[model samples]
Target: MINATILSMFSLSGLNDMTTKHRVTLFSFTLLCYCVILLVNSALIVTITLEEKLHEPMYIFLCNLCINSLYGTAAFYPKFLSDLLSNSHVISYTGCLLQVFVIYSYAATDFSILALMAYDRYVAICRPLEYHSVMTKHRVIWLVCFSRLVSLLCQAIVMIMTSKLELCGSHIEKLYCENWSILKLSCSSITINNIVGFIVIFFYFGHDLFIVCSYVQLVKSALKSREGRKKFTQTCLPHLLCLLNVTTALLFDLMYTRYGSASVPQSVKNFMAIQFLILPPLLNPIIYGLKLTQVRNSVLRLCRCRKQVKGLG
Candidate 1:
């Protein structure tokens, strides 16, 4: 009975009533942004992978950050670009659920990896002698897998719960699928879903708290020595910037989606809806590439080698 009541398709209002000219322009700009995200992130991932010097734990985590940006954006950009060109903005129920899972899991994995990076930095700076033994190749792999698997499981449960929803409505006010939007369509009580959702939210919020505590200890340790301060300034700054970028973007998205003023302009509303999709994926790689000296040198070396090969060909 519940399965029968679930809507087969969802109607999205975010792109409705756009003029033909506006659609074309929006499509072009969005396409450009997606390409840049792919190019920059892929370049960074390639640089880190090909450069043996970047095989350390910090660089490996940075590589995961780049890869996750690609992973997350791949879920949104293609579908969004298609919606921009299509007359009807609709999605199948299964497709919506998959999108929700990929996107939120991307977020979960991002926070997880960033938290791990904070710990890596703490060990390198605060406990220099034990850094190698603690952040070994096997250990890093295990940590990455554990974090991602836990996130996937949590999101899987949420999606399973969402799939059971007996939707009374089909219209979604936003451009894409999200947990809150899907939950809003349910015809019956959603206490269980809400509870599970908050549990997941707090779980990732705990990542933020962990990062803060790690940094607090780092600050104290770094202040004790000039070398410690320099090390923190050199490597840890990029992680902090990336963390701030992602967390702030997420906060903006959540705040606007849940409690934002409807009186705000539609364009602004749209930006708030997609800011996370745009900013973090685009900025994370760039922050690391520019701020980390080793990464900068490695990327330059990679680019020069590419040019030499091209000339020979």
Candidate 2:
């Protein structure tokens, strides 16, 4: 039935009929939004890092969040925008591989960063006495480095392993480089490849969940203090929401792979795409500025300074 439906759709649209204008329009709009998001995120990171008053674990974690979101957006947006603006759907073999590698690399790093941020919050709120020692600048730097390194290693292994296979065709149905779609195009036996993909997904999701849950438990313990409970919840809510977004998206991807197309509705898929790509970057700064008084003041100050400079100029 799936094959018949695909054949019917192909017959209607014609296999070679390339009316990609609509797709290009959608990509263009998304790309513009992402560019704005990247700019704002970068500004926030600069503010946090250069401003002496913003030097704390909370702001440090915000800096990491901004950096991770930038990396994630960078991995996918350049190629997407190129394809959109130029109407060039023809990605080179190497380009496709690089996209797959970079996308997953940043994705893994993003997840790791969220986990570390959760840990930071847990330490800051729950173990206030030892927060500074526990979340030292050196330690955070090492964790960031280690997170990206591990992601790179995983992506390297996947790329090397997949490179050995002969591709049957280049008819990737999806708009972007997805592992399952690429794997489906290979003429070679993909049993081992599929197995590896499953294992990677399992470990990635399980480990991230474990880390996040640990922080949740720690937050629970901290919330027992009546004085800190309200502040702690306010501080942690945004991160919790962001973590939930990531986890749900990963779970949906896994379910889609396991059950094929029937696993999830198309609406759910579309919503997830928007949530992952569009929502988080917009939310992070707002969450910080609104939840924390200092960030709001800093942003207001920056705005006033910019206006003053513009008036003088």
Strongest candidate by lDDT:
1
Best by TM-score: 1
Cα RMSD of all models vs. native, in order, equals 1.7, 5.4
Off by over 4 Å in 1: 1-4
Stretches of candidate 2 off by over 4 Å are: 1-28, 85-88, 262-275
Clashes, model 2: 0
lDDT of 2 by residue, 192-283 (tens): 98888777777677767777677767667766887567756677777777777667765665565455564555445544443555666666
lDDT of 1 at 116: 97
Q: Clashing pairs in model 2? A: none
Tens-place lDDT per residue, model 1, 275-304, is: 888999998898888988999999998889
Q: Estimate TM-scores for all models.
A: 0.96, 0.84
TM match of model 2 to true structure: 0.84
Clash pairs detected, candidate 1: none
Instruction: Tell me how far candidate 1 lies from the true structure as C-alpha RMSD in angstroms.
Output: 1.7
239 Cα displacement, candidate 2 (Å): 0.8
